[model samples]
Every structure is written in C-alpha cells, then in structure tokens.
Target: MTESSLFKRTAAELAEAVAAGEVSAVEVTGAHLDRIAAVDDAETGVHAFLHVNREQALAAAGEVDAKRAAGEQLGPLAGVPLALKDVITTADMPTTAGSKILEGWQPPYDATITRRMREAGIIILGKTNMDEFAMGSSTENSAFGPTRNPWDLDRIPGGSGGGSSAALASFQAPLAIGTDTGGSIRQPAAVTGTVGVKPTYGGVSRYGLIACASSLDQAGPCARTVLDAALLHSVIGGYDPLDATSIQQPVPDVVAAARRGADGDLSGMRIGVVKELGGEGYQAGVERRFGEAVEVLGKLGAEVVEVSCPHFDYALPAYYLILPSEVSSNLARFDAMRYGLRVGDDGSRSAEEVMNATRGAGFGAEAKRRIILGTYALSSGYYDAYYGQAQKVRTLVTRDFEAAFEQVDVLVSPTTPTTAFPIGEKVDDPLAMYKNDLCTIPSNLAGNASASFPCGLAEEDGMPVGLHVMAPVLADDRLYRIGAALEQALVSEWGGPLLDKVPELETA
Candidate 1:
C-alpha cells in the first residue's frame, strides 16, 4: 500500500488496513489530501470541493491514530476520508448550501450525520459544491460555479450533489455525503460512475442539514462501490431525537446485506422493471444498457417482471409543486435580520426592503426561480389547485410504489434518461433540466429508499449509466442487495470498477 495508490482504495479496504496497523490514519488522510492538492486545483480539474479542511482532517486522523495506538476499538469506517456536500451544516466549516446567501456562514453545530461520521472516525475532507438550495438537475446553478464531470471536463456532473460524485469519480475521496431532494444523489452518481444511496426518508437524521424541501430532503452515502456506500450508510443512519421526523427504528443491516449480495446470487429475489421510468425520451444507449443490466439480474436467478406505476408520469410536475411550496416556506428564514448575507442594512432601508435586496442579490437564478414558483403554488388563490393537488398526486405515486412492491422485492430503472449532458446545454431550459429527475422523483415523493449503481458505460458517448433501485421504506437493504449483485457482475465484466475508465486528471 504505497502512499500514491492509497487514494484508490475503497473505504472498506482502507479502514481494514488502518485497523491492522498497515497504515496510520494520518497517512491515509494525507494521501487523500495530497491527491486533492495534486489534481483538484489543476487548470482543467474537477473543482469538486468548495473547501478543504486540511488541518482539521489531519488532526482528526491523528486522533484516530492515537485511539488505535491506545488499543481502543474504532468504528468500521475509522480513518476513511469523506467529502461532505455543502448543504449539511458543519460548525467548523462554512455551510453555504451552494447559494451566495449563506456563503461563508459558519454553522453553530454539526449536522447529525456529520457528527456521526466524526464519531465513526471518518475524516471530513471538505464541503463539496452543489446547486443553489439543491434546486437544479445540473450543478450549473451553483453560485460558485458548476462541477465538471470527471468523465469529460466539458460535461455536467449530476447536481445538486455533483461535487460529491465528482470527488468520488476523480478519486479525491473514497466516501462522501450527499442530499437528495429529487435525484441529487443518485443522478450525480449515475453520470459520474459512482455509487449513491438515498436512505428511507427519516432514516438518516436531518437535524443540521440545511433545509431544501424538508419532507423530501434526505442525506445519504456516495461512494465508488456498493459495499463502501453501505458501510458509510450504517455509520450515519439511525434515529436521532433532535430530528422530529427521524424514524424510531433501528438502522437496517445494509453492510451485511451488501456483503451477502457480493456472492452474486439472487435466487429467491424478485425484481421489477419500471414501465413508466423508461422509454420514448430515454436515450438509446441508456435504455440498451439498462436492458442488459436487467438481463444480468435474470441470469443471477432473480425473477424479473415489468411493473407499471402509471402515476409516475405526473411525478415531475407534482414534485416541482411540493418541493417549491416547501422551499418557499423554508427559505423565509434567510431574511436579512438573521445570519447569512445582508444587503442595504446600513440603518436606512426597511426590514422588508433589506430582505428583498439580500435575497435578490444572494440567491442564484435557479434558487430564485424555484422560490417564486413555490411561493406562487402556495399562494392563497392557487393553494388548493397547485400545492393541494400536487399532494394528492404524491399520494397516488406512493400508492403506485406500494402496489409495485407487493409484486416485486425492488424496482429498477435507468437512473437518468441519458448520460452526462454537456454543461451550458440546458441551463436556459428549465423544463429540460427538470426532466433529468423524471425517473428519480417518484421515490422522493413517496419517501422510499432508493439508490443508483454503476451498471456500465453508455455506448453513445462512452459515459456512465446508473441502474436505479427503489425499495420499500425500511427495506433499504434490498437496494444494496440488488446493487451489490449488479456491481459484482459489472466489475467482473469490466475487469474493474467502471470509474477505472475515467481519463486521468492532470496534476497541478
């Protein structure tokens, strides 16, 4: 395990090595930091991270080393480096939520998951960039700038968690945290050839996560492998009394499930092919790759069948309504009187005027667009017609999932309709951008567990395609099972992880 190759090891492998004294925690952390320094700031680099907590990360790693040296037992992910999305609050670092409004705002406390990661001895490398307020499909809406796909520098990494996905794909970190309001986690993973999981809503505590759509927002693991994501998932998931909506159930044994799935046997499992999630608009290569993945599932002895979730057609529209309506209410806290950015507050303008100026200047275009859309949907006159109706549609989508699950252990689809699209291609086309979440939104709407696993590269552009898996609310282990099976088959076929094909980034 030479230092130069340390960044390429999975979190599981690194943790095992560190625990066995094969490598010091500082050495592991330093390898990642060195990797970040070498490639992250290059002229055409990934630019995945918004901030790198060099001193804090190294110090945390040192503490882990001390604990290990003292013969104390450490968590499974101890000494593993992780990239956290900017939306999650970190007291020591800024929690900007990728919007200029919260830029440079230091949080008062760590997000529950953040604290959990520290407790597990996971070193927080830095905050990754995202779409402002987690409102866009591509990271182009990030106030700082877009996160370029590591697959092709000119392409968009899936957003609002693009930074995390990019970090994994570029080998800057072995693990990362991402929030999926719609498809923020899964879509990015699909585009970048990484693994992302959106745990069941309320499965992971959201105490310090900056609100997106409170009902829909979920923070989950992002990694290069199914097992690695599951390992991270186990550490951050469980009940948190601080979060009112936190589930009161024990976290599922996802790591064990992932390990079990690696045997490549799904003899008794039943899988469903989502009829609504693919077809007419789906790219040829995506559909082809998805069909092949489904075939692989069949070869693994799983019963594959097509299931119809008819209401899924309306998921995009309903999601836009519900998400924005919630966004309108949640974002109201950013008024000029409190923390974050302030404008025209030099003791002259009225409070309302100050708030207007601050938000106008602070929020990026997409954030403003969603806020207005949400406000309009929730407005007195349109509340019943827009927001209320959308809620009804949401219920139907949940019913669709319920009905589908009764027939299958898990549902599958192409995570995104297409591969990574070129940046600037759809920034001005909001509707086109929103379409990216078409397949992923149904799960968020229903608050079920979902994830994206790298299946293989699309022939059209030679970019990655993700196999999306949706499981019942508490049946998150099912997702990892399916993902692990696919991952094992795919890795064997590709001769390695799909990300191994990514072109090497030039070091600074």
Candidate 2:
C-alpha cells in the first residue's frame, strides 16, 4: 500500500494489515515519520512534537515485522505507531514536559505505561508538546512554543496535551497518549475533533507520569476513533505495583462496548444532561449543537434527563486551589542539587544562590505563578483557610457525581464551552484560560471515567464541537458505548469524521 494510504488507515486497521502480512510495520512507521517531517517542522510547523525517536521507532516496528514473519502472535495494536505525551518518561527519548527546567533530560527508566506500549509492540514515534509542567490550558506555555491546531493553524489546539491531540488530528499518528489533570486530554480532543479519554484516576498507572496534582492526574488514550482508543486503552490500563493509587482490577470491556455502540442502540440507557454545564456563558453555536445531540440521543432510544450538580459551580475554584497546593509540593523536588537544568553554579555561587537562580530561570511564567499560589496556599499559617477548604469542596464535588450517577447511567455536557480560540487569545488571561476547563474539571476531581467525542461543527466558525460524557468510576465502558453510538449517528448525518472536513495547511 502507498504511504498516503497507510497514513489514512486507523490503528486497528494497520495492526490487522501487519498481522495478515498485507503491510510491513516498517513501512507504516516510515509513512508517519515522513508525515511528521512534513508538518512537525521547527520553523513553520504545527510544533506537535518536542522530540522524535525516529531510529528507535523504526527499530521497534522492524521487530514487530520480524515477530509476525516468524508466525508469532501479537497484540491487537502491535504494529501501530503512537505519539506519546511529553509528561511520560522514556529511557531512550528526551522527556522535558515542555519546560526549560528539564529540557533534554532523559530518564534512566521507562514509565510503566511506556514499558507496556513496548511490550504490546506499539512504536513510540516521539514525545509531543505540552504546557510546561502541564499547568496551562493553552500550549503557548510550553518553553518550546505552542502546537497549532491542524484544523486552523492560527488557533490553539487544546492545552497541556495539545501536541498529542494535534498529532492525531493532523494524521501524523494513528494513536497518541495523553494525561488529563483537569481537561488536558478532553479539551484538546474537543478542539481537535479527535477522541480522548480520561480513565478513572487509578484505572491507569501513574508511576511514570510527571506529577501535576497527584490525586487528579491520570494518563489515558487519544485517537481518531472510539474503537482505536478502546484498543489502546486495553493495552495501557491495569494495576501497577509502583503506583500506590493504581486500581487492582481488570479493565472494563471497552473494546466490546465500542463495538456494541457502533450498532447504535441505547435502549434503556439513561443519559443525564448536566444542568449547569450548558446555557448562558456557553457559545451560542456550542449550546445549539449540544441541544441537537440531546435530541438525537432521545431518538436513539436513550432516556435523556436534566440533572443538577450544584456544587459543580465551585469545581473551578476548588480545583485551582487544590491543584496549585499539590503543584507547589510536587515541584519542590526540582532543586538545582539534583538533575535537570541548573543555572549560575560556577562554584563561586553558594548552593542556595544556585538553587534560587536555577528555579528563577527554569520555570515559565505560568509555572511560577502556580508555584507561588500553591506555596502560599500550602503555607502553615494560611493552609486551613484555603487549601483545607478546597479539599472539603473536592469532597462535595465527588458527592455530586455519586448523587448524579445514582439517577443516570452517564452524564453529558459540552466538552468545551467554546471551540478553539486563537493561540494568544487567552494566554495573558489566566482566569479565562482556567475557565476553559469548567465542564471537564468536576470529573477529574471526582476521579471518574470521562471522554470527549466530536459531535458536530459550530455554526459560527465551522470548528468542531465535542460532547463530553462522564461515567461512574470504573464504569469506563459506559463512556465508550455512548460515544460510539453518538459517533455513528453523527457520522451518518455528517457523511464522515469531522477531521475529514478540516482544511489542509499550506506548506511553507
């Protein structure tokens, strides 16, 4: 098959072809490397990847080809190439987390998730761009520069995990991995018109993910289709001894759920419409599309009901307080005495001086801002008034989910209040940027299985609109079932995936 044709195939299709000897893994890997070269350039590129592990990727793909040639059995996504989010450690690749602090630092060991990918024979194409320390909503906070939306070059791809989502939307990779500490995965998916899942907090191992908020962060899959995500999810999800929070249980049958949903039946399924998630403050086009999706679900045999989660209004404030407190504590380990970037350490400088200088120069503006806010919140004198209160609010948010789920199988909302905004539009506005995660944060705070699926395009800008679905923790299969059913219904209406309608960028 031609390289172009190979790039267009889904991860499952590529794996099936390789297993059947219809194509070599090397050819598929090479096609993606070529595509990355075309669009991931430094000057006029999408800036999706911070580093590309070209040599290692080809070597891994070749190994898969050899195994297939030897008649050895392989996993479902064995030969599919994936772009990993920078936050995950890889012993062979530079994992900077999009910050100058750890720039060019390669970990000596692979993260559990990275090891799992290799064992499954999935090729790691490279580490994609992200917000520095996963702090900001827009990727413009990256020390390496931002990842542009493939659909609209001037606009932002969703933040923190933008690089991963953009790589899929641009057809640079069949699959990608992302971490959602808040809306890092889902928001980017919403804007990029791709699929992203934030599995239950402990559903996937957090052993190798760079910590943003220990309780809130979870690594999950990003892909072009629900089935592809389900396939990747099965490969990555499971218990890990290294992660204290890891759940010791079998992953839900997500692949089976995706397949079942493709038949488009939601009979007896109850979907809750979050009352606070839509209406005023949401974009006119976004609300219009969400309203239509609710109607469509009704037509598909799903009983749709509006449910109120009042404490959700406090999710934003509570998240900011809790996340920064954790950030301040977690980032304290990056002292100049250890690895990563060190500045002004010419021997003449004292250890304190060098440490202060290094951090001053290493962290970006947003990182510094959060660090300070977190430090202050965590300080002894003021801890109770701020950090302590936020934790209580966190409990309320989780309780809200428990009550809502008691009444419905899953909850639905607009993934993002608006479509992709301009790259620099909200960079200077921290409040505005934080507001972007409004619909997505409650799920993170509650530690549930949540996903964003492309619903339709906004009428105003013709950009993609995503329907956010949240299921009870450990009930991840519900999200896929609903997403697959909704996706099939929408695809039939739109004639194809939304990414197919995205305009190609002009080559420099």
Best by lDDT: 1
Residue 37 lDDT, candidate 2, scale 0-100? 90
> All candidates' TM-scores?
0.99, 0.99
Instruction: Give one digit per residue, the lDDT tens place, for model 1 in 1-508.
Output: 7876899999999999999999999999999999999877624688899899999999999999999999999999999999999999999999899989988999999989999999999999999989998888888898888899999999999999999999999999999999999999999999999999999999999999999999999999999999999999999999999999999999899999999999999999999999988879999999999999999999999999999999999999999999988998999999977699999887888998999999999988888888999989989999999999999999999999999999999999999999999999999999999999999999999999999999889898999999999999999999999899989998999898898899988888
User: What range of 10 consecutive residues in model 2 has the weakest lDDT sum?
Assistant: 499-508
TM-score result, candidate 1 = 0.99
Error of 2 at 395 (Å): 0.9
lDDT of each: 0.94, 0.93
Would you give me the overall lDDT of model 2? 0.93
Question: For residues 386-449, could you state the per-residue lDDT of candidate 2 as single tens digits?
Answer: 9999999999999999999999999999999999999899998999999999999999999999
